[model samples]
Target chain A: MLLYTIYLVAIVAEAMSGAIMGMRRGMDLFGICMIGTVTALGGGTVRDVLLGHYPLGWIAHPEYLLFTIGAAVVTAFVARYLHHLRAVFLLVDGLGLVAFCVIGCDIAMSAKMHPAIVVLAGMITGVFGGLLRDILCNQIPLVLQREVYATVALFTGSLYVGLLYFKVDSSVAQLASIGAGFLFRFLALHFEWRLPNFNGDRIRGFE
Target chain B: MLLYTIYLVAIVAEAMSGAIMGMRRGMDLFGICMIGTVTALGGGTVRDVLLGHYPLGWIAHPEYLLFTIGAAVVTAFVARYLHHLRAVFLLVDGLGLVAFCVIGCDIAMSAKMHPAIVVLAGMITGVFGGLLRDILCNQIPLVLQREVYATVALFTGSLYVGLLYFKVDSSVAQLASIGAGFLFRFLALHFEWRLPNFNGDRIRGFE
Candidate 1:
């Protein structure tokens, strides 16, 4: 139940970010709504499908879609006066990243997936939606670029796995993971931290 | 074997389109390569995941990734002198769309999905990569705005289902579906055909 609540909040935050970005780009209301829906649901939908979960969460529960639409509408009306709200969006995004990472690990564990796969799943869940949003918006994803974003999620997943190894309370473990992820991401952004870019000669190697 | 060959060709065409588009957007070589890989693999990846296929195609066979990179390099060098290659891109995209639609339906049928669901899957496969590319390029998806694009795929899917119902050979059905879809799409584009927009007043209590 707690995880579901966090997921709901993350969805709203994602939708708000997408709507604001779309409006800034001068997209029509329908286009803004589409981006908001896609941003909010894209990662979870991908995770669910990859995990073989049928009738994905948003499709099974129409309320999620409705909530995203509501978020988009709210963002559309408020965006004009929120020109300086980048920090707010960033903060919300941080919380969303943490929540999603924890939830992803929890879901993978429930599905009896390997710990390594769970950690990877957590990172993908936490970051892929923003990646999709940036791709759609014609911008380089911040997670893939100028920030210690994906690494924070990875660390959080590690914490979750560590807690599991020690037989910690599941709820406590989840909270710790979320807190660690949120703090790491927040500090990284505050300090303008980023991963080093590779300047190696091998152009075809994976990063 | 034939389906795999068609899929390979579609991937190459998609990679070419992505590389050309990326160069036109002034992206670097790495960016063009990444875009090309995503464009080539995104739709099939989604289809496979949704159909519960494990170890995604590109993940299972990294050769596809190498092929995409090669195509991107070729496109990057060739696109410099092909500023008037819009017609070529359209033709390639049309062929890719038809091939993907047929393969999508075949995969869905193999998975024992309902014919209606298979048709929807085919349409999704046909358009999803282009949708992703348009979103990445910050352009509205032509599939959504251009009427009859999805309809064409659906029509082809219906033909495939019909052929199967009559005990036609699978290869023959696939070829007929591809030809029908490509021709329908081409005619629609040439004639500037469109679906009529909803003109009725928004109905209350309907989402």
Candidate 2:
């Protein structure tokens, strides 16, 4: 139940972020809705597809699509005011990251997948939607470029999996993992933390 | 038997094309291989997942993975030479497009999907691997931007389905559809046929 609530908040925030990107690209209303929906749901869709979990999350629950589209249309109309609320959306997006990671890990674990795959699944679920959005908008993905975001998902998922392995109560494990992930992302953003790039020449050559 | 043979040729050509793009982006060997594999198999992977078909094509047939990766690596070493043979590759890519469309339609029909969706399935199978490739490489999808590319798949798929509906011999329908799609694409290329864009100002506002 707690997880579901947080997931809702995260998806809405992500959808709005996607809409802002679409507006930046001057995409049509149709394009804005397309990007927004992909941003809000693409990660879960990819995760579900990878895990072979049938009846995809959005397909099964059409209301999520409505919620995402509604958020996007509202964002399109009010984009000018969005600059003022950057901090608030960042906070929400951070929370959503952790929630998405936890839920992803939980789902993978329930499937009895390898522990390594479970953690990877969590990270993919937390980050791939934004990656898809950036790709569609013709930009390098921020998760791949910037600080500690995908790492936060990986860490939280591993922690949750560890706690469960140690017979920790599920509720305690969930809260602790979420708290740690949120703090990690918040600090990374505040301090402008970044993963060290490989020597510039090699990094540029590959990236 | 004919379909399988054509499918093999198509995947190899697509994989090589993906490798060329990777080289243009100055990507390392891993990136080249990743892009190539995605270009070769991504469409089929996406189609099966959307249809809730388990054991993705590449996973079920590891040999395809090996084949795509091999093609990509070869292209990386021969990218300079690829430009000299652009016409040849273009011809091969066109054939592959039709093969992919036909197979996609066949699979969807076998599953007893809606007729409209079957056509869509064919288009997705024919075009999405390239879409995924372009997205990962950070470009607007050519299928969406170019002349008469995706349209060929749509026409071919619809024709195949129509023929099948009228109880045309499966072999005859397949051959005719493939021939029609190939000819349509060839003519479009030769004539520089393009779907008309919306008025520039209005398109800029929305597209």
Candidate 3:
């Protein structure tokens, strides 16, 4: 029940994030709503698709769209004041990332996916919403380019799977993974942790 | 069978196009293969996922990966000589676009989707691959911005549906749609036709 509540909160946060990006880009109302919904639901949708699991989260629960759309519209009006809440926004977003990872792992595990794929699915759910958001915004995906954000997802998923393997109770595993993942992300943000990127600008002959 | 052959050729062409873009972006070998495969298969994968179709095209036909990966690797090696065949490349790409549209339509029609959605599926199959490729390349999707490319897919799909409604032979409809779609794309390219984009830079208050 708590995870479900976190999931709802996460979608709203992601939608607001998308709405802010769209407003910054000068997109129209429909584009803003579309981007917001995609950012909110895109990760789960992609994870489901990759695993051949379907009826998609939004399709089965249409009210999720209403939540995302409403959040986006509201954000469009109050964006100027949002900077005051930036810290709160970041914390909630990080929390959502861990929740998404845990939820994604549950789906893959239920489907009997390989452990590696289950973790991959978790990482996809945690980060792909923002990846899709960046793509629509016409920018490099921040997670792929640098940030240790994806590392947190990998760690969370792996930890959850490891705990389950060691016979930890499911609920305990979920809470433990989510807590650790959130802490990891928070520390990474505080410390400005980043992954190493190769010299992508160094145009050598393709090797 | 004709459509199947065209599908193979299309994937190869799309993969090569992706490889060239990745190479130009100074992406490494793994990046090149990943981009190439995504470009070649992303549209159909997205279509099936959206439609809630299971088992996905590439999952069922793992050999498709071989085709795309092989084409990408080959292109990386022979890319310098490719510009001389730009016209040929363009033709094949256009042809592939049409073929993809027809195949997408057939799948949706069989799934008993609405006529509008069927047409949409075709357009998605035709353009989303390139849209995704542009996303990974970190640029605005060209088709969404300016090209009449999506228009051709729409037209081809509508014509195919209409012809089938009037009891046209299946083969006749397929050939007719592909021919018209290819011609439309070719002319659009040659004449430099474009769609209008609103002033995205004119940042008014969100409306």
Candidate 4:
């Protein structure tokens, strides 16, 4: 039940974030709705595919699509009001990140994958949706460019795997992981922290 | 061997298209390569997923990635000379569409999918990459909006499925489908044919 709740909340947060991003970019109704649906469902779809879950979560449950559409419509109408609370948006998005990381690890562990692969899959699940969303919108993905974004997910996933190694309670381990992820992301944002880029001639070849 | 040849030609065409599109948009080398990879593999990825194949085609075969990168580099240098041949580009893209459509249907039929689903999947597999490329580049998808774009694939897929239903030889059916798709697209481009949209409010309360 707790996991289900977390998933629902994450979906809502993702939908809201997507709608806001699309509205900020002046996308029309169709574009906003499409973006919202993609953002809300993308991570879970990737996770499901990796885990070999067929039919897909959103395709199996049409309500998620309807909810995303609802969020888009609401955002379209209330964007001017929401624009004043950028901090609140950031906070909600941070919570979503933590929730997704926890759920990703949980799902991977349930699938009985290797701890290292689970950690990697969890990180991909937590960050790939946002990365795809930003790429589609032609914005730099925060998880790719910002400090401790994917790192936070990776850390959280590693912690979950460590606790599992010790035969710890799954819920407790998940909660601890989520807390750690949230804290890491919060601190990174507050401090404007970032990973150092390798500014070498090797990196310049691709440019 | 025929399928392999067609696939290679399609990849080359996609790579060239991506290089031209990227250069036109002033993207750097990495961006150009990324676009080329997406253009070459995007359709196949969607096809594989819809057919319930996991890990994706490119993920299963890393050589496709390497080949796309090589093609991107070659096209990047040659694009300067090729930029003026817009008509040639369209014709090449049309060929790619036909080839991909035939391959998509072949794969679907191999998977024993229903003929209707095979035809639909074939059309989707033929056009989805270009749709994604256009969407990512912030342009309206030509497949969605332009004259006889997706329609060409659809017609070809329908013909392939029809031929299969009539117990036609696989190679003959494939060739006919490719010819039909190419001819449809080419003629549409030459004559500026288009599907009619319901400008009048036939379906009320929708859009």
Candidate whose TM-score is highest: 3
Clashing pairs in 3: none
Residue A25 error for model 4, in Å?
3.3
Candidate-wise lDDT, in order: 0.78, 0.85, 0.87, 0.75
- Residue A195 error, candidate 2, Å: 2.7
| Model 2 bad stretches (over 4 Å) | A202-207, B1-45, B54-130, B136-138, B142-207
Question: Candidate 3, after superposition: displacement of residue B126 in Å?
Answer: 11
Fnat for the candidates in order:
0.08, 0.14, 0.18, 0.04
Model 4: residues with Cα > 4 Å off, grouped in runs:
A50-53, A197-207, B1-44, B50-127, B135-207
Off by over 4 Å in 3: A205-207, B1-53, B57-131, B140-207
Candidate with maximal DockQ: 3
Worst 10 residues of 2 chain A by lDDT: A198-207
Per-candidate RMSD vs. true structure? 8.5, 6.9, 7.0, 8.1
- Can you give the TM-score per candidate against the true fold? 0.58, 0.61, 0.61, 0.59
TM-score, cand. 2 vs. native:
0.61
Which of the two, 2 or 4, has more DockQ?
Answer: 2
Write down the worst ten-residue block by lDDT for model 1 chain B: B198-207
Indicate the residue-level lDDT of A184 in model 3.
96
Q: Report chain A TM-scores, every model.
A: 0.91, 0.96, 0.97, 0.90
TM-score of 4: 0.59
- The prediction achieving the highest lDDT against the true structure is 3
Chain B TM-score against the true chain B, each candidate: 0.87, 0.96, 0.97, 0.90
Candidate 4 residue-wise lDDT at B149 = 74
